[model samples]
Target chain A: MTSTSSPSRKALSKIACNRLQKELVEWQVSPPAGFKHKVTDNLQRWVVEVVGAPGTLYASETYQLQVDFPEHYPMEAPQVIFLHPAPLHPHIYSNGHICLDILYDSWSPAMTVSSVCISILSMLSSSTVKQRPADNDRYVKNCRNGRSPKETRWWFHDDKV
Target chain B: MAAEEQEVRMEVEAVQAVYGDDCEIIHDFPPHLHVHITPRTADDSSQQFVEAILGILCDAQYPQKPPHVHIVDSKGLDENREKHLITTIENKAKELSSCLMLVALCEEAVELLSDMNHPEGNCPFCLYPLLVEDQSGTFAPFMKLMSCYHCFHSECIIRWWKWLQNEIIDSKQCDSTISTSAGNQREMEQQQQQNCPVCRKLFDAKDIEHILDYAGTNSSQPTDVIVEMDGDERKFLECESENNRRQQFESLLKLQQENSGLIEPRKEIVVVPGMYLPTTVMPTLAAIDAADEQHLDSGSTAPEAVDLNIPSNKATTSKHRDMNTRRKNRNHSSRRQPNVYPNRTQWIKKEAVSSDP
Candidate 1:
């Protein structure tokens, strides 16, 4: 296995790299409020730290988000997942895969890592309960072979939370 | 009272007479109507970025009471512009006082719109000025998606378009392979309608095809693009700092492997240390969670929370991973703030200037 999970994809295309770098610069100028980008030289991957909004159920809690960008980045959605001990949330699973649509099918090129982070934080902020998804065990087991979350055909629940 | 009713009816008829198809009268009494306004471009939307339909509803007291004018619908205007338009109309209503100001308010909106009728702020793609104002007379060219007036720099949009087309072709190839059931969804999205990068509005191939080869959107920018592309590719892998960071990340991974009892290496999918059968898993998972808390308490080895909760002194082990503003700037392409959006963004600039001390 390639040390990294992005073997199914190619290297960041020239345009994707260019666009991501632009995102990086913009992130520094004004990062999404409740999230901080953990500096990594890996242009294709970003590890950002997120804090729960003050009044949210996950308040004062911190979580790590690992975002892996595909070669066709803006055209394709990034693979975003939480690191284990994933903030116990209904949409986030035990294995760290987040069931967020923008991280998958609904991603738009105009959206940046900052926007996605904001969306994730909002998702956490709106969460009324802190627990794993009902099928956390099954989902984690299915991902035993290290299938990227992008491979899972997620049926996005309505944006209720 | 009959004469006053006649006067109201006459005013309603006058609104119909002037605006014709552009006006929609909701009620004849007291004249509640919606007026569609476009700048003086002879209906050439390609040159137009803003348009609005205004609703004006006058009470039965007629001219003695001012009508309520509000933006029924608008496009290409931000919150500030919308507020500006409403504020101006309210002030205009007060100026007209007891006069029939429906038509006057509509006129003011059209004039105000024309003044703000250019694409403003940043291109959704690169987050840079869609129309840069450089004296070199060689700024990046930009265009709007016809389906929606959302605009982008020619190169930025074209590059995204090319990637989309490539993705479609790639997915088509996957239709015959081990690709998941998403193949059907892929086939459906395979049609000529690609989404607007900004609004997700579907746009046709022709929207981008015209600029596929713009004889180059800018001579200097293209060369800069090529050099940057090569440099970025190299920078991601072979650059000294990048290799160094890769090593650091590797060392962190190795550290995670060594401390696998406390934390899991998410990327590796290695069997979780305390993970076992489900019947007996709960208590152990709880124990692991406690171990996790203790590890977090120990610090450094705790991925990001360690960095956030205890940023400075506690991160001495991975001091390089600290969030320095300069380090953040170095990893990406620096997009400058929108200082001068020469046209449509003038209101934003105006707001900033007024807010400044």
Candidate 2:
């Protein structure tokens, strides 16, 4: 448990504004063709649409991924949740704090907004198991008991799938 | 890690721009790099004016921090090149200012070399005017190569470099202590000399060397070397054998602790079965809790659940703590491993389920 110092309100605001500006600039650039993005500070919501899937479990679904940034912008990682109804995967649970090392313990300042989006896309594309984590109910219980989603420890050692 | 890596890369780029494929930036700089930049101020030369301006920027733009720049050459003290250098520096300063927030502490380095009066006192580490050299003639002249942000003697820097070099050598030797190839094992076997590199203490290296010899030699020596053998030669050999066995055991344990990440420090705990927190694991858990409580006290939002599974029974907890204390007392302490366990509720649930079944 590392000590996380709170960024000053002014610093937080400035950081948020900078990140927001960067995001806006990206949106204005060559937009992801057919996909749309929506952001709202009130809900602390960040949404992005994914287009063109074979309608398998996720086909034709305008999957909306949610991103929530903490006050300490770059210091802490964002909370990424899948808002759209989705099939369960062994790595993902009902509440969507991702199992990725990058989002939690291994986040690097070099990672930008676009890289995060690409990570999620890759996570979705590569998943093969059709279950909501190895121990689904235990994971949810841990979350409700105020444990971090990561503590449940879904071991994804097998990369074959 | 990334930020430090990037800073090194930027420094390399800066060097590359001037040297232009002629030099490679060496990574193994002495811990304290001493730099001295003396502007070539020739009379009425435009370059002198440029140098004056650059010097002013060095002083005013970045006060308190030593300038990371070192004058590579004092040749061609001409006017146009001086103006060009000033313009180059101004542009670089502007670009650096844009990254002021991330590079704040580093930028202070500019002010380090700017001060002329504080020559003898400049910190070789931070290049600050804090550290004054000992008047005793212990400081080396090579220390003037780069102003260390904190003043350190040239010999001190060289000593640090030597220590780092030796450490790398030791680590590499430790890694190759075991060899899969017969040829390499034979080479190591022949290289054995009974002595400790550190402390100049004597140790029985022959026994360890024998293990290296035995490992790939089809186990020619007896499975166990008996201590109470008849001859004095045999007794000495047995002692060496015992020492080698101990060395091998310690090395294996250290290697396991490094790779497993299960040991005392709570690096990342993904619950798994048959995982007893690595040896003497209780203190690391205690440290984690202390860390958490400190975080909360510092006013970061309280974490969702303390979620640490530090055992409750006073006897068992105390016993575990004692084990760690004893390990710390042991001479060869490599790293402290953390005691990580499944959350109490989950443990109870599993126990209940198993009991019912």
Candidate 3:
């Protein structure tokens, strides 16, 4: 599961810390449906449990998402990955990396953790097939050194989930 | 008919008063009026973002039949918005059928215009409402692209534009490193296509540059691109602390003057002949002298004499006479440090005697 693996060594900046705190408060007030934030002391890393939507192929299945914020977070996208025993999904790699554009090049500062969570949940809920990506084994081997998903140049060829 | 004519005349006068120069009478006989209506919001007027010129045609039957309202011209408003505006006004006129409703109709038009004043829909970049709907009523100010009429929050568009510029600059930097013909071709392609973030419409840099000032002022985020680009965080922190240190020094000086009569009561301090000191430096000298006297009374001579010599060396550079005064100051500084002061005093005394001849 690479439980001890950290995404980046850089510490969160003051602005990133402040914004994350705000997001934490908002999340506590009204968390996204099908998601539960695991309470932890660390502000830089968040582990959330996602319950697959009722109608999806992975319905009722539970998956863990690990979100690690970069130093220039909000400006930079958080590295979001599924924990080991990842769901069988075409866009998600076996190494837990997800090929989502918003978590990479499409990221905007205005998007918060809550918004990202919703986008991921929606991506999961709309999947028509339960299968790993074609090159998942090769990609996972390449990322054996614990590479962040943000470093991946994602090719978002499919608009459909 | 005469009474009806008077009522129409009064209504026309009322509309003129309400709309001022916006209300223009094309023909007086049948009361053909043109009223230019814009939203009441200050941004709408400054941007000229939305406005409608309504032409009202009144038949001879007049008040009995509601006046015909049609949109003559408008900017930044689509056909649907224009129709909705005229329809709302026409409905108001129908309700006020038998009475002189010209002024009321114009007011209603203004009210509706204001309601629909803002640029519609979300910012393309963030997909958030540009004008937020909430109790706080805070919304990011939006600007319309002059060429395409596509609107976006000032901050969003600016950020995207800056990001594009940075991408180009970065590519240019990479080109030099690569120095390949293929890289040059890619750079040329990037230069040729700086499309609108939303529409992919070709827009010149000037289109966004014109509103750069507005974007800068309207930005709510603390971290601006300029600050990030400069990356002078250490320099900014140093300057801040430097200011704090200066302020602390000034306050300490002020406190010392207040406690001890360190400074002469301004008017009474006659300037010493041939001694030129800035007013601020004078207080510092007086404070040092006062501290020196206190040290002498306490009989701690060695350290006090050393401290006094340091100031004397700094305060007087050209004159041997100032040196004599400083030796006197040092003598007064501490009685216990007689060995150090006596030697300096003897040297100054000899100098004074030699200069007197």
Best by DockQ: 1
Worst 10 residues of 2 chain B by lDDT: B348-357
The per-candidate TM-score of the B chain, in the order shown, comes to 0.56, 0.19, 0.42
Candidate order by lDDT, decreasing, is: 1, 3, 2
lDDT of 2 by residue, B87-182 (tens): 555555555652422123223322322322122343322222333334552322222221111222332332232232333334445565453344
Ranking by TM-score: 1, 3, 2
Interface quality of candidate 3 as DockQ: 0.05
Q: What is the C-alpha lDDT of each candidate?
A: 0.65, 0.38, 0.64
Native contacts retained by candidate 3: 0.00
The candidate that achieves the highest TM-score relative to the unseen native structure = 1
Q: Output DockQ, candidate 2.
A: 0.04
Summarize candidate 1's per-residue lDDT along B282-344 as a digit string, tens digits. 223323322223233223222443334332445454543432222332232122212211211
The residue-by-residue lDDT of candidate 3 on A1-161, one tens digit each, is 45325556678866568778878887898999999999999999999999999988878999999998877566567888889878899998877888898888777666788888999899998999989999888888776666666656689998899
Answer with 1 or 3, whichever has the higher DockQ: 1
TM-score of chain A of 3: 0.95
Model 1 residue B60 distance off true place after TM-score fit, in angstroms = 4.8
Better of 1 and 3 by TM-score: 1
lDDT of 2 by residue, A87-123 (tens): 3666666665456666664554334556677766666
Enumerate residue pairs that collide in model 1. Answer: A21-B333
User: Looking at candidate 2, what is the lDDT of residue B317?
Assistant: 46
Model 1: residues with Cα > 4 Å off, grouped in runs: A1-13, A39-43, B1-5, B59-66, B133-135, B176-190, B213-357
